[model samples]
Target chain A: MGKIFQKPEALADVDTHYCPGCTHGIIHRLVAEVIDELDVRGRTVGIAPVGCAVLAYNYFTFDFQEAAHGRAPAMATGIKRVRPDLMVFTYQGDGDLASIGMSEIVHAANRGEKFTTIFVNNAVYGMTGGQMAPTTMPDQITTTSPAGRDTDEVGMPIKVSELLAALQTPAYIARQTVIRAKYIRKAKQAIKKAFTYQLEGKCFSLVEIVSTCPTNWGMTPIDSIKWAEDTLLPYYQLGEYKTPNGAG
Target chain B: MTHEHLVNRDKCKGCGVCVEACPKNVLALSEDVNAKGYFPAKQARPDDCVFCAICATMCPDVAITIREIADQAPTENKGGK
Candidate 1:
């Protein structure tokens, strides 16, 4: 075997604290692999946000800054404004980006900040014990919505990529998943494009990763992947919401 | 036979799964810590490898790669490794 798959060198040699079958680990590896391939590991600066992946700063080999909950966009904006030469990105969760950080994310996209954002959407908050997230599926049971999320009561899940694509400032926006190899390959391509857009000085690149929360969903690791595919994909729909070359 | 090993010194976060994933007992915790100050995973035995890339595949980081050791010859290429 001439080494077909392994961890990328850009990642830190530490075990992830994410739950088994959690999509956070997969998303992180994808971003790190992108950095390695782009050869921007040395100049990249990632802003780590609150929620399950708040500790993401410890996983990547690049320089990192821990921002307040729902404040990663602001932090990344400031960093990029000051250090325009650096490749800046933010790693935010659905709870952090779609919920309280909603204002910041919207403004960042509106202002067209030249930064990359890896938005992990597991439909629920995974760090603070599986609470209902803004992206939570209709009737998806969570700690707050134990009887499943009622769309009539809780409203429908917010389509972040679609909403952001509507904004003219953002240069790239995409929604992808990591439940299987076929999707994973596409997600990697999307991630690489987002980074490439950022390197080209394009504005507001975001990759919304429809992820899995095995512990919160009350399913085994394998089952969680299946649930994400069967339940989440129908709503999220993996594809490029926006692209620099005008390709969707 | 070719052998594969994954190394993610910074991404290891000291999870120790690679050490357990190896059936050949070829992996061990490194004594030298990385920038994160975590003991990274290391190859305990390189020569005994049967080219099983399980350690690399099992890695959450996907940080390891299996390579064939060729003598004074160019390495074989793959589509993606």
Candidate 2:
């Protein structure tokens, strides 16, 4: 009756290394809260990626494994196979999941790995000085794409959620944002649903979050929200692209 | 008197996302820096707070905790023959 909202017990008391206005912290907190609600804190294991979220291990109280660049899905598969009872997830960014590690993730999802994957698509390689990632929006300005991304040369940003949803494997795939409060609610629900699907042992799950890089985007935190809504959301969109047959 | 919040100044990075998300405009980033040399968000108008928790919902750091006052119960008599 006294507490309305507080940090989840599964989350650590340490401050994250994420930059100010970065949504990675929000996503981490959501995952922690979901883990808390599922009562899987003791059994859960997270695979940290090589990008900006490399230090993701410090934010969660659960166990974590640092994987080589773009090898998180492969590592998660190994851990889940040996210990199927343990809940497992991978915290990967666009550069780690959609680009260099695309093969690993594609194969893992195609094989229907029994684990959850949180794909954070901020549209650029943040840790590496905001290089042009495969998910980087066309016509967007990045360090590598100095004169704005050229659609003619690079095609279009990869829609990883939709691409994975096209596979026949029974999996939960969703893309949501946390730019605003309303979006945060939906994003949390999407994440919770992904974890729920994995808990049921029904299928693999991936929640592709369309995030923002305020520092890299050269915009203030508040302005980044508007830019993400005006620029990023139109291309990435939002909604659950796929769900298991029994998922209702 | 029932509604309140504790913002962890040390953990907060002065992102201002929570301040922008507040519906009642009761929160503001402090001009003075904290131990970490970052401006932490604080309640500017506590009486106007409705405890919507929108700030907590949007906070990336999970530094804000919203709470309510709990009612105290009367002492029970022990000498029950």
Candidate 3:
């Protein structure tokens, strides 16, 4: 065995500020690994959202831009159009994408922007405490929904991937989870494919990764994973929702 | 002295995700805390290690790294040179 596994070079070699067991670190590492694998680190630009991953720029070694809350997709679209040669992506959370930035992402995806998006759906507003989000699971307890989310009043949780897939645009869309080691590999595969689609200028791509927020969920990291597997996974439903090749 | 495994102590938040995923029961959280005040995972029964690499995959902090150094150059050739 010679170097079975090691940290990707695109990632900065330092301790991050993420809470222990937070899957944002895992997703960040996966993106860095994909960037390294594709040899695009030199020309890659990342747009960090305004949520918990706002410090995403600090973790990645490549050039990064901070976007206004819910506006990462719009920023990414502009960057991709201006510098078509560079690889651009946005990292966003549920609240940033499905709520405040819903129109930005929707129109960007509909316009078939060449940039890719990595949407991290932890089901709540993690950065600003456990506030209810558009993707918050029904009957889930959140700071804003202390009595548990009532689907009747707020409507059911928004299925971002499915909603995006319903669009007629030929793009790459996939939903994957990182709640366990087994799922991490699959999630990386989906992420890599999203970037690969962008590399070929196929179309707009969004990889919705169902993640866990241990701090906001008020559970141990392990318990959070179990809770997500039991509660969140059932609703999000992981799979490729769209592809340029017309294969699901 | 060969490094069968290496862990960056500072990088490890000691969430025990790797420990729970290790099928061989090769790792355990140490009693002593690191500089960050978190107890990191250590090899408790290294001989049982199969080097599955799942620990590295599960470690969100990128703390766990697995290395394997063959004793010698690979003897078998599967492709024609």
Best by DockQ: 2
Full ranking by lDDT: 3, 2, 1
What is the model-wide C-alpha lDDT for candidate 2? 0.88
- Tens digit of lDDT per residue, candidate 2, span A1-248? 44499889999989888889899989998999899998999999999999999998888899999999999999999999999999999999999999899999999999999999999999889999999999888788999899999999999999999898888784799999998889988998999998888888867899999898999999889999889999899989799888896332
Identify the superior model by lDDT, candidate 2 or candidate 3. Answer: 3
Q: Give lDDT for model 3.
A: 0.89
Compute the TM-score of each model's chain A versus the native chain A and list the values: 0.97, 0.97, 0.98
Q: Tens digits of per-residue lDDT for model 3 on B1-81?
A: 133566677778889888888899888888888899998887777767777788888899998776665455423321101
Better of 1 and 3 by lDDT: 3
Give each model's clash number.
28, 0, 1
Per-model C-alpha lDDT, please? 0.81, 0.88, 0.89
Q: Identify the leading candidate in terms of lDDT.
A: 3
Candidate 3 colliding pairs, count: 1
Residue A34 of model 3, lDDT score: 96
